[model samples]
Target: MKIPFLGGRQALLDPTLVAPMSTAARPELTGGRRIGVLVQHGFTGNPASMRPWAQDLAERGYAVEMPLLPGHGTRWQDLNKVTWDDWVATVEGALDKLVAENDAVVAVGLSMGGALCLRLAADHGDDLAGIVVVNAAVDTLRKDVKLLPVLKHAVPAMPGIANDIKKPGADEHGYPMTPLRAAASMFAGYAELRRDLPRITIPVLFFRSAEDHVVDISSSRAINAGLSSKDFEERVLEDSYHVATLDHDAPRIFAESAEFIERVTREQQG
Candidate 1:
């Protein structure tokens, strides 16, 4: 008997097409400042979704690190065995390394990657200059999520939420199926994240796709209501979806993020 979405066969992905390799760049000092940036991809997503953005930053002479999260950049079935803590630990380790090596560090993330960045800011704000989150999720209104605890035990996977981009031919190369246990762990941690939002006192640059299909507006609203940062800013992506980092507004995201990083890092120096 074959389960609907239980195994690696459900992915049907061409591994080469995914561009799953991790990205790292250690450039010469920019304006005599040793600045670093940590770029992160979302849940079930590899470095493919964030490579372009990470590359753009690296070109600007900043140290950049985009690590492949455990259980990602591989078969979807492997994700089922990992928990949310595994994802957070990966990004946190990257941030720690950057902080120790640079005068200032900025963390940038997409989707669930954004949530991990926020967690870092909350716990390590003093070590970070700022953070940028694109289509980040902190809270959800999806009633079905309440059943995740039970559903995950019965079903191995569900329909995927990847590639929610408005641009034609844009692919995040994420999993074709959502592993139930992994997803359940992600949503389960949101409450704790929300509670710690007040701890994120550093500057935050938030990007929300106007037509996002994966993460809803409730997340932005929650961030707006919960953050204690006076430097919080939200920009709307008019022509993109959940994967705005890879959508038509990608250039805008890169340009603005570069400016944000420069300004925040400079400000930290003073």
Candidate 2:
């Protein structure tokens, strides 16, 4: 019984989820001037999760790169083959290339990718045009986590068994079933960066799901309260799950992100 590459995930297993390992000769970006929107998927997710959002943004005129994480897009065992740092590096590399081609670079990331973008805004302040974080996993110690402590160990550590029996949505992606070590690394990165949130001074947009089950909803306020940037905006998605980027609010997310790019591009042009 050989497991297929997709494992019957949310997508139909077409194109096998294109990874962004090689930033080779990409076609010239049209519809807008040198603006790139680099997308980051969740811990166990592949590029497929961000595909809808990427396509939406691309249609509105932005170069998008939804990179498959180092060990993701494959099997659970492969995730263990890489570390948190490797995942972060991939994101940074993608952003670098986007910035290289485009005069302005903006980023929109989900979950851990959100954390990576925040860190980049803090460190690479001068380069970024802006950032939009949807369900940004800035902090891990949410009130819900305390309420349902068992989920922490059960979901990622023992996937297909301990995962979210309450909501089958999580199981749909067929995300890495078992990556306990990788799970721990995720929180560590989030924690290290939370202390540095104030360092992020670029114009930022934050999308928080009002009915989120995974990430701490308060993170939106936390990011808003902490970031040094004066041009920060936060919105709440009334109807959606943790992965709002793939769920109901995807289009609104794309629209607002496009607006962010346009606003920043205009500012740069002016």
Candidate 3:
């Protein structure tokens, strides 16, 4: 699908274009066996939400790459035209690039971004050094989600769960509306990820908010139960919502993840 932009130029299904209020982080040049971290934002969201975490890692001498998912960070209406495949392909391509240049690569994501990171862990297994997620969802408690198949056809869109941050003035730069078709595809991706959870055995770190309006805590429980990672840890975000990466607990998430990355990569290097 072609999205017309300024100057009458069209966006060519490119997930790399830095959207307004969103920026794609480039890996920093660090010496030695460099580490690469692929950070992804949640569905209906852009790299803006994940940028802070990516920048944190970059400052610590780790190479970071954040890709804008297809149909995201653009007009919400365009989301109806894309599917889960488009989102997966974008991150997969980003992962390929990072793996090639870095000694060890870590995947970090939030919400649906977390689901995608889990997908990478499952697909790459031992190839990945570790995985980190904030308020990731593999399953949810929203009853309406079960009717997505029927609702997606009748209801074109619904109220979005963007900017679910408790902080007074923080915005995730997410779309204002949630296109049903895109949401259905996202749920479908979650189902597939759940089924393959056991395939992910790498070191995994999860940050869950104590009060998340968008994704219920049940999703975290399900993920913890399903994952086969022998080295797994869960951190509680006491003062945040679903968008914890942009909320009050964001610093803790960043600091803990940086420390986690160091420990995991050191083990791998040894």
The clash count of every prediction, one per candidate, is 0, 0, 0
Q: List the residue pairs that clash in candidate 1.
A: none
Error of 1 at 104 (Å): 0.9
Instruction: Mark the regions of model 3 whose C-alpha exceeds 4 Å error after superposition.
Output: 1-31
Task: Give me the candidate number with maximum TM-score.
Answer: 1
Name the lDDT value of residue 110 in candidate 2.
79
lDDT of 1 by residue, 3-24 (tens): 2344437544455544533334
**TM-scores for the candidates:** 0.93, 0.80, 0.89
Model 1 off-target regions past 4 Å? 1-29
Query: Candidate 1: lDDT of 133?
Result: 97
From the highest TM-score down, the ranking of the candidates is: 1, 3, 2
Write model 2 residue lDDT over 116-197, tens digit each, in one string: 7898888787888888887787775544334333454555444521122133353224353657667666666776777888
Misplaced by over 4 Å in model 2 are: 1-15, 18-32, 142-156, 160-178
Q: What TM-score does candidate 3 get on C-alpha atoms?
A: 0.89
lDDT (0-100) at residue 22 of candidate 1? 34
RMSD from true fold, candidate 2: 5.2
